[model samples]
Target: MSERPDISTPEHIRQLVDAFYGKVRVDPMLGGIFNGVIQDRWPEHLAKMYTFWGTVLIGEQSYQGAPFRPHKDLPVQQEHFDRWLVLFRSTVGGSFQGPVAELALTNAERMAAMFMERIGFYRDHPERFIQ
Candidate 1:
């Protein structure tokens, strides 16, 4: 019998991020919205995403970037956020397998909820989210 190899490393996270973005980059709703905005900084963004996943799954602290600041200026409405969540969930579901996928989905859901709440708060109280 062969023992299962661990598949939740930073490399795995990187693969997942790449796969996720592959879908996102082609998404009709999200593609144009984030293209020019994040094109130049995509590498850094991917690294940060990797760190965020690492922190969540492997107890790593490599992520120290502000996530919300970038999107604050985007043309994102509530429906766009909802579409993003659906696309993200679909991406993860298509790319991952087993427990890794489950963990990723759970974390993604939490993040989507938090982002929606933040957007709501920002809409209602712009002063609160101001940097």
Candidate 2:
């Protein structure tokens, strides 16, 4: 393996997001849910993710939307989030280092926890999620 570099550019974010989603697209546990929700919109989803990570890691303000709303109703649970973190950490760990990489991992952990908690909340109170 080559020396990993810090994630400090749009291309780095693109690489990470692209590679991570590439894995997710084929993952048995996650693929069905993601592909079903995304289907022909993978490109759009990837672009949004690039912006989302760019903003989260690099302080860019490009992404502006509710990241959790799309995921609130997904048929996911702790295992799904666990798989996601494993895949994500492997992707980032395989190619990145330094503070940004750690930030990405930390942010992912927090995001997953928040999403899971929110999903559980909505599940217990479906009426709160009505549009």
Candidate 3:
């Protein structure tokens, strides 16, 4: 496989966020859930995502919102989180390489685990997940 470009700038973060969400918008498994909440405010949501990823992949402090609050009320299930990780991993792997990409994947994995645990997926079905 060809090597992916390094994610070293805000532009790269923006690219990853935009590309990833674009796929999410069209994904059969995740589209409905995301569109149900995002509705017509895709631009705002994408902007926030860019800021979130920027802060995550770099030291940018543009994002300042609760990451898990929006998801708390969503009717998301374990399948949804799994699909999200699948898409996210694909997006990062397709677009980036190097330490930043590794960090991005690590952060995403942690976020997924935390969200799953908080949503009771881990507690309810401890055998399904690996700690």
For each of the candidates, give the backbone clash count. Answer: 0, 0, 0
What's the residue-level lDDT of 30 in candidate 2? 96
Better of 1 and 3 by lDDT: 3
Residues 31-110 of candidate 2: C-alpha lDDT, one tens digit per residue: 99999999999999999999999999998889989998899889999999999999999999999999999999999999
Taking every candidate in turn, the Cα RMSD to the unseen true structure, in Å, is: 3.2, 1.1, 5.4
TM-score of each: 0.80, 0.96, 0.88
lDDT of 1 by residue, 1-131 (tens): 54433436777777777887877888898888877688788887777888888877667777777766666556677787778778777766655667766777787777777777777778788887647
Tens digit per residue, CA lDDT, model 3, 1-131:
68788798999988999999999999999999899999999999999998999998888989999897777557777898889999999999987889999999999989988987776864576576443
Displacement of the residue 100 alpha carbon in candidate 3, Å = 0.5
The candidate, 1 or 3, that scores higher on TM-score is 3
Show the colliding residue pairs in model 1.
none
Q: Lowest-scoring 10 consecutive residues by lDDT in candidate 1?
A: 1-10
Q: Candidate 2: where is the Cα deviation over 4 Å?
A: none
Steric clash pairs (candidate 3): none
Instruction: Give the runs in model 1 whose Cα sits over 4 Å from its true position.
Output: 1-7
RMSD of 1: 3.2
Model 3: CA > 4 A from native: 121-131
